[model samples]
Target: MTKHTGAWSGTVAKKSRAAFDGSNLYRRLAVRLDDGTTIDVEVGRALWRELEVGDRLVQDEGGTPHRGQSSTA
Candidate 1:
């Protein structure tokens, strides 16, 4: 896993699940950042289930990932 700090906001490019050990899985989002860079951020299952491709997402400083402007609730 990579260490992501500061604030990052982006559009959801895609969703995926990764398996390392046979017994565990991790959900992730391939986000296209506002600056045009793509990043894969791991997320909780519940939240992962709630998002879709093209959805706008933002993670403010010291906050959790959530819907952003132009995204429907």
Candidate 2:
């Protein structure tokens, strides 16, 4: 299995939806990292509900971090 270690912080740029097997809806987000890199991060329904465009995100191997709250200085 692949392990996602540490964490990556970014902002939610957009949301996407896809239907798999004809009826299963999948949600993903386009995150623009602080380094100017963009990546697609797949998320579950619970986390999806908490996320919105422009919201800051931090994710680790365990999954969504800080319950989707934006990081603080």
Using lDDT as the measure, the top candidate is: 1
Candidate 2 positional error at 15, Å: 0.7
Model 2, residue 29: displacement in angstroms? 0.4
For model 2, residues 1-73, the per-residue Cα lDDT tens digits are: 1333558888999988888668989888888987999888777888778878999888776666434556676
Colliding pairs, model 1: none
Error of 2 at 28 (Å): 0.5
Misplaced by over 4 Å in model 1 are 71-73
Q: lDDT per residue, candidate 1, 2-66, as tens digits?
A: 75666989899999997877788989999999899999888998989989999888988878788
Model 1: C-alpha RMSD to truth?
2.6
- Clashes (candidate 1): 0
> Which ranges of candidate 2 are over 4 A from the true structure?
1-6, 61-73
Local distance difference test values of all predictions, in order: 0.87, 0.76
Candidate 2 structure, TM-score to reference: 0.73
Give the range where candidate 2 is weakest over 10 consecutive residues by summed lDDT: 61-70
